[model samples]
Target: MFSLPQRLAAEALGTGLLVATVVGSGIMASSLTQDTALALLGNTLPTGAILVVLITILAPISGAHFNPAVSLVFAFRRELSAQEAIMYALAQIVGGIVGTIAAHVMFALPLLDASTKIRTGGAQWFAEWVATFGLVFTILAALRFARASVPWLVGLYITAAYWFTASTSFANPAVAIARAFTNTFAGIRPADLPGFIAAQLLGALCALAFAGWLLREQSDATQPLNAEAKP
Candidate 1:
C-alpha cells in the first residue's frame, strides 16, 4: 500500500483522468448525435466503461474515491480516516479543475461561459439527488457484501444508473465541477451549481444513513454465531 500522500496523489490523477474522459466524450457524442437519447447513450456508455477500468486499476492504490461524497461516505463507514477524507476531497476538486483545463486545450474548445452552459432547474436538482443517492447506496452495498468484487459491481451500477437517472448520473462532485469549465452539452452553468451540489450532498447523507442500517443488520446477524461459538 502507498503512503497517504502517494495515495492521495494517485487519487487526484486518477479522478482527473476519469472526469476528462467523461466530459470530453460527452462533448464528442453530443456533437455527433442529433437524437437526445442516442447522444446520452453515446456519452455515458464509454464513461461507465472507463470508470470500471479506472476503479479496477486504481482502487488498491488510492481507494479510487473520485468523488467528495464518496470519500465522505467511506469516512462515515470507518473505511477512511477523517484527515484522509478531507485531503482526498481537496485533491478531487483541484484535479477536476486541472482536468477541465486539459480538456479545453486538447479539444480547442472555447472558454466556458456561465451564460451559455446548461441551467440547473428543479428537475435537474432532483436528478442530482437521485443519481448520487443511487451511486452511494450501490457502492456501500458492494463494499459490505462483495468487498473483493466492488470494482465490477460499481461499474455495472454506474452503467445502469446512466440509463436510469437524469443528469446522466453525473454523481461525482468532481465531474460536476469540471463540467462547469466546458461549454459543451455536458457542462453545468456556474449559476446553477449550488442547487446541484446541495442535492447531491443531501443524497450522500441519506446513503450514509442507509449504510448504517445495513451495517447494523450485518452485525446483528453475526452476533448470534459469535455467541454460540463462545466457550
Candidate 2:
C-alpha cells in the first residue's frame, strides 16, 4: 500500500499525462484533418488505448484514480480510506490544471480564450449525462466481473463511449478540467464546468448504487449454498 501522499501524487501525474495525451492528440488531429468527426475519432481512439495501458500499469501502485468521481465511488465502497480519497480528489483537480497548462505551453495553444474550446450546452448536456452514466456503469461492472481484465474492458468502454455519447464521453473529472485550459476544438468552457461535473458525479453515484445491488444479489445467491454445505 502506498502512502496517501504518494498515491495522490501518482494520480496527479497519471491524470496530467492522460489529459496531455488526449488534448494534444486532438490538436494535432484537427490540424491534420479538417473534418470534426474524423479528428475526434483520431484523437480519442489513441487516447483511450493509452488510458487503458497506463491505468493497468499504475493501478496496483496508486489505484490509478485519475478522476475525482472514481475516487469518490471507491471511498463510498469502502475500498479507499476517506483521507486518501480526499487527497486523491484534490490531487486530480490540481493535476488537471497542471496538465492543461502543460498542453497549452507545449502546443502553443491559447489558454485564456473561450471561443477555441469545446463545451456542453443544449443537447450536449444530455450527451454528457449519457456518457458519464455509461462510463461509471461500465467501470463498476468491470471491477466486479472483470477485475483481472480491467485494462482492456476500460479501453473498449471508453472507445464505445466516444461514439455513443454526444459529449464524447469525457467521463473523467481530471480530463474535463484539463480540457478547460485549452482554447482549442477540444476545450470546454469554465462557465459550463459545474453542470458537467455535477452530471458526472450523479452518474457515478447511480452506478455505485447499482453495483451495490448487484453485489448483494451475488452474495445472497452464494450464501445459501455455503450454509447448506456447512450442515
Candidate 3:
C-alpha cells in the first residue's frame, strides 16, 4: 500500500498532467486549426484519451481524482476522510496551476495571466451542474457494475460532454480554477470561477444523493470505491 504522502503525490502528479493535457491540447488545436469545429474536435479527443490513461494508471494510487468535486463527493460518502478530502482538493488545485504554467511555458507564453474568456450565464452554470452530475454518477455506477470500464466510461462521458455542454464540460472545480489563470483557448474568466465551482460542488453532492437512491437496490451502490483512499 502506498503511504498517504505517496498517494497525495500521485494525486498531484496525475492532476497536473491532466490539466496540462487539457490546456496544451487547446492551445495546439487553436494554433494549428482554422475551423472552430475542428479545433474543438482536436481538443476533445486527446483530452478524453489522456484522461483514460491517467485514471487507469493512477487509480490504484490516489483514486485518480483530479477534481475537487469528486473528492468532496467521496468524502461525503465516507470513502475519504474530511482531512484527506481537503488535501486532495488542495493538491489538485495546486497541480492544476502548475499544469497551466507548464502549458504556457511550452507554448512560449507568459507564465501567468488572468483569463478574459467570458463564461458566465444561467445556461453555462446549468451545463456545469449537468456535467459534474454525470461525472460523479458515472463514476459511482461504473464502480459497481463495470469496474474495468470506469476509465473508458469516464473518458467517453467527458468526450460527449465537451460537445454537448456550452461550458465545454469543465466538470472539475480545480480545472475551472486553474483555467482562470490563463488567457488561452481553454481559459475561463477568473470572475466566473465562483459560480462554476459552486455549481460543480452542488452537482456532485446532488449526484451522490440521487445515485444513492437510484442504485439503492444494488449492493455495491453504497459501497465505498475509494475505501482504501484509492480506487
Candidate 4:
C-alpha cells in the first residue's frame, strides 16, 4: 500500500494542477474574448479536459479527490476513514491556494486579493446544491456501474454544469475557498462562501443516500474511484 504521505502528495499535486488549469484558463479566456459566452466556453474546455487527465493519472494514488466535498462523501460511505478524509481535505485546500498563487504569478497579477464578485442569494445557493448533487451523484453512479468512464463522465458533467448552473458550478468547497482569494474571472466572494459550502455538504449527503438506495451492496464491487491504486 502507498504510504499516507504518498497519497496526500498525489492529492495535493493533482488538485494544484486542476486549480491552475481552472484559474489560468479563465484568465486567458477573459483576456482573449470580450464576449462573456466565448470566454466561458474557453474556460470550460481546458478545465474539463484536465480533470479527465488528472483523475485518470492520480486515481491510483489518492482517488484524485481534489474537492473536500468528495473526500467527505467518500468518508461517509466508509470508502475512506475520517482521518484520511480530513487530511485529504487539508491538502486539497492548501494545494488550491498554492495553485491560485501560481496562476497569479504566471499572469503577473497580485498574489492574493479577495474577490469582489458579489455572488449571493437563494438562487445561488440552490444552484450550488444542484451542481454538487450532480457531481457526487455522477461520481457515485459512474464508479459503481462504469468505472472506466468516471473521468469522462465527471469531466463532461462539470463542463455542462458550468454553463447550466447560475453560480458557474463551484461545486467544490476547497475550490470555492481558494477562488475567494483571487479577484479573477473565476473567483467568488469570500463572504458568499458559507452558503455555498453548506449547500455543497447537503448535496453530497443527499447523493450518498441516493446512491445507497440505488445500488445493491456487492462484495465484488470495486473500491469507489480508487480502482487504479496499486500495492
Write candidate 3's Cα lDDT for 39-135 as tens digits. Answer: 9999999999988999999999999999999999889889899999999999999999999999999999999889999999999999999999999
Q: Model 3: residues >4 Å from true position, as ranges?
A: 218-231
TM-score for candidate 4, residues paired by index: 0.92
Ranked candidates, highest TM-score first: 3, 4, 2, 1
Looking at candidate 4, what is the lDDT of residue 173? 92
* Candidate 2 per-residue C-alpha lDDT over 67-122 given as tens digits, one digit per residue, 9 for 90 to 100: 88889999998988898788888898888778777767787866534534546676
Considering lDDT, which of the candidate structures 1 and 3 is the better prediction for this target?
A: 3
Estimate, for each residue in 1-231, the C-alpha lDDT of model 1 and write its tens digit: 689988888788878888778777777888788888888888777778877888888888998988999998888878889998999998998887777777667778764433257757888788889989888888888877888778777778887888777666778887788787777767888777788888888899898897778665544656656555757
Instruction: Tell me which of candidates 1 and 2 scores higher on lDDT.
Output: 1
Best-matching candidate per TM-score = 3
Model 1 TM-score is: 0.88
TM-score of 2: 0.88
* Global lDDT of each candidate: 0.80, 0.79, 0.92, 0.92
Q: Please give the lDDT score for candidate 2.
A: 0.79
Cα shift from native, residue 210, model 1 (Å): 1.0
List TM-scores for all candidates, in order.
0.88, 0.88, 0.93, 0.92
Q: Which regions of candidate 4 fall more than 4 Å away from where they truly are?
A: 217-231
